[model samples]
Target: MTKVINIQPVTRIEGHARIAIHLDDDGNVNDAFLHIMSLRGFEKFIEGRPAEEVPRIVNRICGICPWMHHLSSNKAVDGCFGVTPTPTGHKLRELCQTMAHINDKILHFFSLQLPISFSGRIVILRFGMSLESLKRRLNLQPRL
Candidate 1:
């Protein structure tokens, strides 16, 4: 007989996902795979689109990475239009990119990194053990 195991809607990711483990007759896991069942085909749909439409189209690819998509698509638009972004536009774009980095870093620290680092029943204890060592590394903490 076959055995099937499922981890439904794994909670930690930015979006929904499913994990599957298939077991053979001896009940050992013979196969494991992860699937993101939802469709966000922005990357696929971007192909063959008009060059001018890239900035508007790709910007919606990921709500979390819109700044990156915007930056990339803006470059594509500039290339297609045979024009360069003005100095002011470049400066503004740089500021947005910097802000995006800050947001992503916060997300990593609070939601992903910190949780894993503090795992187990005595999470506070684990964190306490490393806190002093971590505090000493000026480079590890983000500069406000």
Candidate 2:
């Protein structure tokens, strides 16, 4: 017999979602799927908006990766306007994007990867360290 296990409202995520894992007769994994249930309709919302304002509006689409959305929307607007950022501006944008990438990696590592990797065990720190303390111990300066 085959069975399907559904995990709904996946924890620690910003939106509603679920994962379905299928098992075959041998009880081994056979297939899986992820279902995302929320719809923001950003496209319909952004229609008829000024190009300059779209970037700001769309940035709210994803709380976890807002910078990526903002920067991408800015690029699209620039293309529509045939506007090329100066060399300095381009470098600054790239720097911010890189920083966002690093920030995301650090966040995911601590929030998602570490717990799973540790088999959901609570790793105690010597002095009841928090994430801030861990970052400080690692010599990571806050980006902004």
Candidate 3:
């Protein structure tokens, strides 16, 4: 006989996923596959837009990583322009991206992990304060 363990709707990731662990005849875990259920066609959508529009267009791919997408698209557009950003622009972009990642990490850690770590109403306040402060500092304009 075979057994399977499925974990659906995995939390705290960029998107939804279903993880299935296959079991051997004795029911021990043997294999696993992570299925991404939130796949989108952003590539196709951006294919024909003007190079200048690429950044804004691709930024809509996901609310979780719009900064990454925007940065990537900006790089691609810069390549098309046959010019690279100046050292100052590069530094500013890096700073903004770093801030975005820090904000995202804090949100994930607080909302997902802190609840299990601290069981109290204060956790909610902490999460809210952290998120709000990060949002203000990063100027994270939502794309979704």
TM-score of 2: 0.71
lDDT of 3 by residue, 1-144 (tens): 668888898865667899999999987889999999977888677777889988988887777778998998899899899998999999999998999899888776776565534442224435346766644434534333
Model 3 local distance difference test score: 0.77
For candidate 1, write residues 73-127 as lDDT tens digits.
8987888789988899899989999999998877766555664444421122233
Candidate closest to the true structure, highest TM-score: 3
TM-score of each: 0.62, 0.71, 0.73
> Any residue pairs clashing in model 2, and if so which?
none
Best by lDDT: 2
lDDT of 2 at 39: 91
What's the lDDT of the predicted structure labeled candidate 2?
A: 0.82
The CA lDDT of each predicted structure is 0.73, 0.82, 0.77
Over the stretch 1-144, how does candidate 2's per-residue lDDT look in tens digits?
Answer: 789999997976667899999999998999999999899999999999999999999999989889999999999999999999999999999999999999898777766555445444433334467868654444533233
What C-alpha lDDT, on a 0 to 100 scale, does residue 10 get in candidate 1? 81
